[model samples]
Target: MRSRLHSPTVRLRRLAAELRRHREANGWSVSETAGRLGWRSPKVSKIENGESRRLSADDLDKLLNLYGVEERGEREALHRLAKEATVQGWWANYRDAFGSRALPDFETEASAIRTYEALVVPGLLQTPEYAEAVFKGAGLTDDAVSIRRLVQARMERQHILFRPPAPHLWAVIDEAALRRVIGGREVMRDQLQHLVNMAGHHNVDLQVLPFSSGSHPALSGDFTLLEFQDPLDQSIVYVDTASDVRFLEKPDEIERYSLIFGRLQGHALSAAESPVYIRDIMAGLESDDRE
Candidate 1:
């Protein structure tokens, strides 16, 4: 997870998004760009959309020339940005791991995040000790120093959830997660208490699905729908399995995730009552701990 957040290649995607804006404003079709570049239309579309893995400086020069960028300084900056873009797909190496890469980008631009978590409190809601304990339980073994560093990174990531320009976060947790002692009794109690504390914030809306809700949509794995303020920009779906993390794009797939989130939200406790519901779970956990 720490490895995923330290990537620099992700910066280039921001540059790519900028170039796309200029192309749209100029009303250049993919075929027109293809004609100017002496390449196929698909190539132009892929680079403009930040989907090109082997982007080159020469290709960037040709594309910018087609856009009639007369200023030398502006052109140079874009050239450097393109050169930097050639770096490895920041998230590529970790493609088989978790989807931590998407969170930074999402934190930068997402206006709202609707998450359906089936088995635990979201990472953003984890206490430092809870994060450390959960990582250990997940088999993230390390000496004292490595464990501290990893936990610190996870803690830093949580700042995005409470930053000044924070996005609206709607997290739906299942009852089973509330019941599970992820990091033993004490850590689980701390984690649940943290959830109750975060629920006090207006920007954060936390809801829990009780057992009685039974057999609703989203019995599947965990997923999150990230919506941006710019409607022209497409939304993203973050899906996590125990082994792999997938960032999805297809419109229909995103819609399915969104629809499922809507249904789960209905089954969850209301915003005002969510803390109350979770506190009850915490009390139950505390009682069991005493026994």
Candidate 2:
């Protein structure tokens, strides 16, 4: 059990996994470890399973001591991670705008992001007008203030694209996304042009899943696979549905999503050819505007 809603949430899970690993390495069961620390047995399980969000440095130090971790460097690293796990990220400020799982926080820590969008442009690449339209169409709420907050939060999430050590983002967008005019034709025109510009970036790989590729992998829906550089921290697959957001970390699930994403990349246009394909679409949209 894990709460991977935010960056700190993921960090917390990693910390818990580490503690559990160390405890088992030293031949300490949860009950035995809790007895040594003078705590209830369930408390140890809570800490190791990431059910406890109140993980503190002092608590971590005690666990390390009980586990007989003599290495100072290892101790300091775990301590730092513990601190980070509890710290609130920028997205925390917009709690009302987000659902249970914090997508922005996960994006911030991911080293590479692979996404497949079947209907609309991915959030990271959406323009303000396009984003506003998407939100307005969702019928989430009628409150204008709440809508603005959600849009702003999305725009803020895009900042990671320009930050130092930006993550490699590979997005496979369906051709239908281009034809579906959200926020009117002008808004979509600008959005398509934006895609062309973003594709030129070294870290951005944009591909169009052309209509010609029928019955391909990922026909069920859209999903994102996030990869981390650290071996200790495993990759994750995120799926957003009408009801809720799901985070998949089990090895088999991750492998399944990875395979699906791989097949998607195979079916989509090559990154090098995506820009021209987009430009041609833009031309078609322009021609339609004249007629």
Candidate 3:
């Protein structure tokens, strides 16, 4: 389980990384920097590690001054980031449904999202009925109210798709996911239709990896790679397992996944053909319904 304390917002993470970079470039150890500021070592460590409960403007200014960051524009930008870090996003209201996970926070900041789904439709593309079915199928909770809340939260997450300057969503879904049939034929049909519809969105690119493609790189599991507009805000890969969720930020990890996704795209049907492919599957489902 992700600890609530350590799940800093994306802005906070960027701020922390910047501060750490400045300290390193100045060739000052954490203890030495803390000593220079007359502050405890842990305080410096926490701020650099993105574990601070809250970062004050005063503290940020002090750190910038020590680093000799005299450029007014740069200082003002960092100050804006510090202020933005403290503002709670709409996701905060849904904490009960999402726990302390920062996936939504990161998603909110992402400028482009590349995702590969092997089991089911990506959450951002799931319909309300399909989402409800998924939550219930996972046995995440027995309470009907909780399931409803989760479904609502999932739907709300999709709002980013429609917002102006929407992040581009490039999704490669496995054929197995399309054929799995969740929430009965009617629901699954609707879900497939939703995918086809979403593919038509200007910012969304959808592809289907048929089973016949066989022996692919991401045969292991699903992962989402989020890229931010700001260069300082590094890209991250999100992996969710039955037991836990992991965020990968290392350059090597990102590169490996990027390669895997590129391969997956190569194996999958192209954007132009994918919706047609889904419609074919939907035709089979309709045939099944009529039978």
Candidate 4:
């Protein structure tokens, strides 16, 4: 049975895929395999699906034996994967802020992140004040403490961009998001300046999709596509909605989103031109403040 208490981490997912592969290679159906091991079918399903909290060494050994996996090196590798899957990531410490969402966990391991934002700055690029404004705007809660906690969690997530071998971030933001004046004139100004500074980062590529771009492929909404260095950890597309977040991993879905993101980049202002466009908007905000 799937355990809500234990959300699947990437390592766990990788291990699960390996287990499923081995079972398929053995040509044993889930029911047939469970029958051989005296396990209920769902128990085998849980492990293969990465829904189990943790797979004990004995259970893994039994499955390996059942699959005729006799190589000492292969056995040790699978055992190590099982052990690693049970370990919690740093994001687990902020459960109150993130709940069951696993985006941060995956972002920590992504080698490249391509994102399209229709109505706000991407979390990784948001300033503390702007982030606070966003949370407040969402009306997610009235509790000040909760808002602060959420903002803190967002700021912490940005640490990945500064770490060694940082992931490349290519963000395409719609013009409406930039003109929305998210945290009032001053906050918005500072936020724009922050964006200008971040755009200069070697790993960050910021592009603006102007209003003139007109009805684009991603007009449906915002989404992020995360790619990993490891072949086993396939690319995933993440969509965040008001009520729930969806992680799409199917090959077709990945391909579709990838094509959409490429089109977004194409429609957006070039990286060199983006900063100039932003500064002009900042100039307008400043002029309005003067008036």
TM-score of each: 0.77, 0.94, 0.93, 0.92
Candidate 2, residue 256: how far the Cα is off, in Å: 0.5
Worst 10 residues of 1 by lDDT: 1-10
lDDT of 3 by residue, 38-141 (tens): 99999999998778848898999999999999999999988877777777777788999776775788887688999999999999999999999999999879
Q: Give one digit per residue, the lDDT tens place, for model 4 in 6-99.
A: 2247777888888899999989899999999999999999998778869999999999998989999999988888877776777777789888
Candidate 2: where is the Cα deviation over 4 Å? Answer: 1-6
Which should have the higher TM-score, number 2 or number 4?
A: 2
Instruction: Estimate, for each residue in 1-291, the C-alpha lDDT of model 1 and write its tens digit.
Output: 223222233445556676787787789877886886789988878777677756677777776777877899988877766665554433343332324454554544567888887877787788988878767777756566667766776676576677666778899999898888887888888888889989888889998888999998998778888777655557888877767667887989988888889999898889888889888888998788679
- Candidate 3 local Cα displacement, residue 116, angstroms: 1.1
Q: Sum up the clashes in candidate 2.
A: 1
Per-residue lDDT of candidate 2, residues 173-234 (tens digit): 99998889899989999999999999999999999999999889888999999997667678
Q: 260 in model 2: Cα distance from truth in Å? A: 0.3
Ranking by TM-score: 2, 3, 4, 1
Model 1 residue 120 CA deviation in Å? 1.3
CA-only RMSD, every prediction? 4.6, 3.0, 3.4, 3.4
Q: Candidate 2, after superposition: displacement of residue 290 in Å?
A: 1.1
Candidate 4 TM-score, true structure as reference: 0.92
Residue 233 error for model 1, in Å?
3.0
